[model samples]
Target: MISELVMVPTDEAVLTGDLVVPGHVPAVVLFAHGSGSSRLSVRNRAAAAELHKAGLGTLLLDLLSEREEREDAATARHRFDIPLLSRRLVAALEWLAQEPNTRDLPAGLFGASTGAAAALMAAAERPERVYAVVSRGGRPDLAGDAIERVAAPVLLIVGGSDEAVLGLNREAAERLSAPHEIHVVPGATHLFPEPGALEEVAEVAGRWFLAHLKERRGPGGRRA
Candidate 1:
């Protein structure tokens, strides 16, 4: 496996990211962290590790620069700026497409919290590039009309005990025109901090990405 630090250039700033690829990987998963979180998030890291073990490459990125993170921490503005985040994500995806190590691999998005909205919007914008999407404890509703435009298969994972967010996910799922499903982790809350709860999420997410990515790849490791 190879792990490298990558700087993704966006229109406004250069975002830092960690790119890890296992030997002979056929697909890659890009993570979109939630509000107030970064590439160092333990939960997202755990999920990425599992996906790697499942033979998928993973890219975890910081959506904001150091100065932007500090400013957003104070004003809480950039975290909820879905369009800005989506554009940044799109830029990262474009960068991946040009990179030799990951360009040939199918790409998927795993988003958490508001990042989920950005992931959905980006997937909608680049329908042919994104093979699948998974949202963990995310607000897909925040993507607005972009939800209806998404062409990739989507999996929405929510905590069983997080009634408020579960409701929001349900409403958002209704607007999706793509193949989608909602999975609830019993006894888990919005963060899925309960024992074994996050592992369940990782398992479901890994399976979903692998299955869909492989399907998209088809025979002879070529895009179908």
Candidate 2:
């Protein structure tokens, strides 16, 4: 419940996020927030807090520049840009890999909406570095070519009624060579911010990361 927020200097802008370290951090999660959202996004911040309670360290990152956000950012209603966001997500990972308190943590990604695509793209680009991936109402189809290359196990969490995106996620799942699963939150919509919905997403994601980020495994869940 009591977590700390900090900003680390990236090669470019100073990257900001909260880090919640448990008694012994079993793994780390880097949060990629969706369109027009910042590291302060409440759903992500809450999820990070829960993950820390579940024994994972969290780094919730902001994925864009003020200038780019103002000029090219999506409108309040529709602001999802996959490609531009992906690059920034990757850069944030590179920054985390060097930051002292986080450097050696076995890293995973928790991405929402378009942020999911960026997380997948980063996982693909830095296969050896990223250990697991989870997408909440993700548009990972937007990741296109990068989805097939991801080395970590991926969990795609979508709202059952978010039909079009669900189809896109299924299509992307077929292309992934990594160990993967797609779980739909029944009766939920794109946001999955409904009561108990975010909680379900966090629980599933924590379990997935625990399975994949470990040094040894024996089918509490599958692995790639």
Candidate 3:
């Protein structure tokens, strides 16, 4: 595997990330962390490790710059700014397309909490480039109208005990015209802190990304 720290330049800011590409992988999953989170989120890193074992690359980045994170932390301003987050994700997608090491592989998005909304918005804005998306305990409903425009297959994974978020996912699923599925981890909570819950998430997500991103196809074997 090739692992490196990289900087992704956006129109507004330069974001930092860790890029890990396992040899001969079919796709890379870009991680969008939720509010108050960053590239170093433990759960996301753990999930990325699982993806590596499955022959997939991963890009985990801080959507906000250091200054922005600090400011947001103080004022609680930027974390819920979905449009800003989406723009950052879209910028990262563009960067991936031009980056020498990752240009040949298809791309996927793995988002948690509010990051899922940003992922969906980015998928809508760059339909041809993003092959698939997976949401872990996400609030995809916050994508607003962009939720209806996303063309890639999506997998929405929610904890069985996270009732409010699960209901939101189901409601969002209705607005999505693209192929999607809701997978509930039995007896798990928002962060999947249960004994085996997170492992189940990583396994299911790995399978979903492999299925859709490997072939750039939707459900029923149709090209996306």
Which one wins on lDDT? 1
- TM-score for every candidate vs. truth? 0.99, 0.87, 0.96
Q: Which of 2 and 3 is ahead in lDDT?
A: 3
lDDT: worst 10-residue window of model 3:
215-224
**TM-score quality measure for candidate 1:** 0.99
Whole-model lDDT values for every prediction: 0.96, 0.80, 0.94
**Model 2, CA-based lDDT:** 0.80
lDDT (tens digit, per residue) of candidate 3 on 60-153 = 9999999999999999899899999999999999899999888877899999999999999999999988989999999999999999999999
Model 2 over residues 18-74: C-alpha lDDT tens digits? Answer: 766665675678899887788888889778878877888888876755655575554
In candidate 3, stretches whose alpha carbon ends up further than 4 angstroms from where it belongs are: 217-224
Candidate 3 lDDT for residue 109: 99
lDDT, model 2, position 139: 84
lDDT of 3: 0.94
Worst 10 residues of 1 by lDDT: 213-222
* Model 2 residue 166 distance off true place after TM-score fit, in angstroms: 1.1
Q: Which pairs in model 2 have colliding backbones?
A: 74-79
